[model samples]
Target chain A: MVFQSWSYVGFLLITILVVRLTSASWRWLPLLLASLFFYSLTHWGAFVILLFSIFYTYFTAIRVSGSAHMSIRYRWLLLSIIGQVLILGVFKYLGFFNGVMQGVYALLHKGDWNDWPLLVLPLGISFFTFQSMGYVFDVYYKIRKPEMHLGKYALFVSFFPQIQSGPIGRSKEMMPQWTSISLPSFEQYRWAIQLFVWGLLKKFVVADRLGNYVDEAYDTVGSMGTWVWLFILVLYTVQLYADFSAYSDMAIASARMLGIHIPENFAFPYKANNITDFWRRWHLSLSGWLRDYIYTPLLFSKKKWKKWAVVYAIGITFVICGIWHGASMTFVWFGVVQAMILICEMFTKDRRLVWAEQWGRTYQWASVVLTFWVISFCFILFRADDMYQVAGVLADMGQWNSSLLTTYLAEKNISRLMGILFLLTMFLWGDERWDRWIKQPQMSMNKSVLAISLMLTVLMVLGVFGKNDFIYFQF
Target chain B: MSNEELTARVYGVFRKVFKNEGISVHRETTAKDIAGWDSITHLDIISGMEEEFDVEITGFEVMNMSNVGDLYDLLTQKLAE
Candidate 1:
């Protein structure tokens, strides 16, 4: 069940009540059972995958840590990582490879290759796998000790709130808290409810609504003008940010109410002035994971290559990042485009800085806008159906038709569009404005009542109850 | 080398890599304590230290060094060996 659904809300309320009422010794029982129940909601078969990941990584990590010989530890680490990657490959990309092979056979004039029936992707496979594998890496590297308790480690892997869409908690940060379950404080509850309210509003009022427009545009991109395509790209970018960050916000808020703290995922990414800065701000958990686990090792592997090593590492890391998203060539191309832009930014860093100094803040603002547009275009690669659609959109960039807007206005009220823009601006630039306003120490009873009333009003008006799956669930 | 001597050489490497000769480091100094000591600059510093001290540092070892003090200890131990 998705977080935005009433069923999940009811489930969470009951779970919170149980946690609050239960003793510390038996607290993991309820949460673990709740998490397993949540996973069972996805597919009964998926639990097998999650169990394999948790047990395999858990056992190997302990073995890696206990081994005195570097060779033995390294072997365990390699085995664990490779095994996790293979599982991810089988579930996430096997069908993708089969399709590519079929195309190859067709090109070679061979008869059709009978493809096996595809397996359904288990929910949160990417997230839980990455998190568990990170723990194994940490243990092998001696960065932290592995948790010996199976239940706690399993909770770390299958934490219900973040299981579907994650801020991707690390074992070191999460395990200690999982071992010690406590009732949330009054202040924690207050903050959690506030964050939940805001996240719900963003997802319901902004992201889902924009999703409608994005869907309309993407479905008809062939007939849509350049202006329509541009609008769709911008809307899709905002929709993605809103949708994914809303999931993270809700996940983090839910965890916090249970006295758990997950990391923040996004930080005003559209405000980033360069591709490098953008990566730092966008999907921060994944980016940080890639930096630490992939980029660092690859960059350091061949120091003789010097700065070239950074470039190569970045390219490879982003390609992996792309593949981690899905098993599509478009995703791979998205990574390639991002890597190329970043490399260009790197090569031109000195020149750009000099230009910035000469031209001042305006140049920097232009860079920010340029970066946003570049990202939006790359996201087209991410969101488009195939390479043909990508080529069609790019080739038709110059074609403009004013009728698209006129027709939109004829169909929908301009005031509603203005309202959406205002909401999007607040959601983007003033993301935490409501939270900050609510957390004021001098908050009066009347103000609190008014805020609650406003929240209820928004929920009743804009919240879509069904089809509430978050965008990142496909990963 | 003594701890003090090893720390001095480490300081030289940090100064050159971070490009700030005046920047001071101590036992508790971490990435946040210094400017431009982010992930990318971190590799440059690691490479600089390796070149300066002629010690082979693995990625695992680098990951384990929480602060300058750990690096100093590792370097001194490696140098003594």
Candidate 2:
């Protein structure tokens, strides 16, 4: 059922055809059924959990909006959010908490504690929970009205294109689109196909090719030299962005073919000159959700704390962001590192602005390079399985062995690796140029067809079709 | 205060918080329209508005404000109260 597969292609085509043939008012019926069918294919148990979440959030939202008293509305909002958090905690963090307890027992030299049986993490549990909880929050704040239709609400929560990994749709944006689904026009379909093909090039050709090297380096981190570690750090960052954003592009394109628009997830994040700018551009939807729901409330509630409130908000928000990623300490550290950098940036904002004015282009270029390295180093925590592996990787960085670099260079696939890197560079360059051209109204259909054809050819020739699951699927 | 007076005061708060005396905001002005108006500086603006108008703004009201017009409306209601 993965979007990258041929079977998914057939499923999407059939679903689109059926929806198009269905009456306008009833288009949602086929889409809802298809989305549920898609989820059910993942796991029946997880599907049941998703259904429960939809029902619980749906009913809770209605109750919140229905309540006349502020206290009552607050209570319901708190109850619903806690319920969602508890569900996420059990499914996603039980093992993490259990490991902490085991460490305590081992420290006391007691008998080994039995391991807890971890539940299967439903795919995209984090995404759906956050999305649904955001809906409830909006209702409480009166940002948007609660959708009274149960089926439409269910489709909003479980929409197949975004359910697995999201550009996390808001109810206000997505609910209205469902009530009036229509077939995409010829131009729209052409653009969507071009988008999908481009995503395929990124995922199959660039990401997977790079993933090969990243995996091999991490697999033998203890034996790697500094040069190998450097490559690992940089390559893993690229691999992650390519893999996750590729998924988003395809998901958006799939939804676009149905004339539904999801939010853009990435915006040339690597071009950002600072950590703050990077967050604004990277994983835009999730960051928006966090800012609106978590950070804003936390900061406003403690506005009297002044600058400390910003620090506190950044710290707490990113810790939650980290835990939202997984039940691992590595992820927590990842969040902590980002929060620390952001806090530093906030305090030094004025100083940096003055430096930007003084140093001009050189300062901006230096800032971008520094920010990229900072992010790449932080991603080491993201990529490592455990602290021990992270330690091993860092320790390997001190081994300055030129012979190892020479051996790596002499590997048989070096030419292919270089070719993939070239393609990756070209893709990034083309993306910037495409953004500039897309805003202009004179874009020709012939150009789109040619671009799509070229991308498909490149994908066929170079794509590593090992059926790699998108990296974000686990989160 | 009149609506125009309230808007002018709001613009003053924006200028003070962002440290740009020449900054201009319209009814449609959003965070994107200003250089330093982001999530980090947003609280400063809210606090600045509160200080300027002597009104307490809730998170609910803040969340509802999408543009300067919405903020002007919120301030008008708060001032009326």
Candidate 3:
């Protein structure tokens, strides 16, 4: 189930209550059952898809582990990754791919557009597929041992909090936690509540409000002026972050509440100085999963041809990543632009090092900011509906007449922009830096704790706009 | 090759890959210690070391490789056995 859904949360609360009363060993079962119910609720017919992944990977690992025949074991691993990816393609990309193929065929005058029809995308298909593939790839590399138990493996893939737009957990980070039964500790509950409230604020107070502008602007990009275009670009930056990260924070918080600790998926990504650094922080789980499986394996393509390998690695990984975002050309372009930047960063590393050393930290920060703006501008392509709209937005960005500012920046727009700026700055800034209280207990205060708790209560009451799914879910 | 020569060759490979001057051969040096030692250069260094030392690296070896010393040990074992 999507982490924000009340049904999933309700089931989770009941499971936590049961675990609090019962032994820890049995806690895993209730959550596992809840997770199954959660998945079934969304796409009961496709529950078999997750089951197929689990059984395919589990048995493959069991059969392949420490096997004498290396090629045979590797073939199993390849077959598993390929199989899961094919399933992911069917569920996630069938419609978009078919549409695109039809368009391409129409352009070529080889076939009629009516030949291909769109298909319904199964819920959580992208995330669970990636998680399962990562698990199987980890086993193939022999970095992690296969989980012998089928139920546990299923739980690992279908864990409710991360079943939707994910902090996609790897076998190494999550499976052990999956096997453990959590106790309902007060500390965990406190943090969970705090995180959940903050996420609620992000989604309702920030993302939804910003969406009011971005939604309209994107829906009709042709009439939009430069100010409107710029505003939407900035708004999209915030909307996407808040929408996805709020979901992430809620997932982490929900999992924490159940005494299951999930990883932090966002890390003040706006503060990132470079595209590479931005990537390092943004959608951290997926990037990391890509790194571990796609990028690292591509590194092993060959030794003597390693330069080509690096180029190929970055190129292919991002292609996979791009397509993973959706069955769309925009997402593909986004991935391509990111890959190009990464490659340039690699190629110019020596010069950059020399420059950084001579320029100092502030200059480095400025450079990173410039890089972020360039990346942000590229995201305009992503925000646009099609090539025509993309061209229109680009023209708007370039056509800066100071005279148009007064007409476009109405008082309402100004207030919205200011509010967005404030929220985004707060979101981008590092949370609660322990700047020199390193020796001391940094977060010390029982009195302030009450104040914090009260703030959370207020935030939750004020913040939830209610029932918005994560933006990435559509992809 | 002796462990010392292997270490020297690997160090040379890293120096060449990273394009950093005055890099000294040491078993303790890590990727973190060198400027421009990102994943891209990492592959270059590993590939160069593999070619120079004429030993294949398992993905496991690449995963666990931390410091230059680990490379030395892996190289030694691969060459000797």
Could you tell me the TM-score of chain A in candidate 1? 0.95
State model 1's lDDT.
0.84
Go through the candidates in order and give the C-alpha RMSD of each one to the true structure.
2.1, 1.6, 3.5
Residue pairs in collision within model 2: none
Which residue pairs of candidate 3 clash? A273-A368
Identify the runs in model 1 with alpha carbons over 4 angstroms from their true place: A403-405, A432-449
Model 3: per-residue Cα lDDT over A88-199, one tens digit each: 7777777677778788988999867663544446677888888887887778667788898778888888888888778898888787875566675565576566667567
lDDT of 2 by residue, A4-38 (tens): 98899999999999988998778888989999999
lDDT of 3 by residue, B1-81 (tens): 775676667768877876666876577888667765677767777778778877788765787666888888888888889
The whole-model lDDT of each prediction reads: 0.84, 0.88, 0.73
Better of 2 and 3 by DockQ: 2
- For A1-475, candidate 1 gives per-residue lDDT tens digits of 9888789889999999989888877788788989989898889778898998999999999999998999999999999999999999888899888889899999999989788677879998999999999899888878789889898889999999989978898877888787668888776677677678778877887788988888777666666667767777888899999889889889988988877788888877998998889998999989988987898888878656777887998899999998899888888999888888888887887798789899998998899999889899899888877888788777656667788667766666888777777877776677556546854545655766677678768977987655568889988
**Superposed Cα deviation of residue A211, candidate 1 (Å):** 0.6
Per-prediction TM-score to the true structure, in the order listed: 0.95, 0.97, 0.89
Highest TM-score against the true fold, candidate:
2
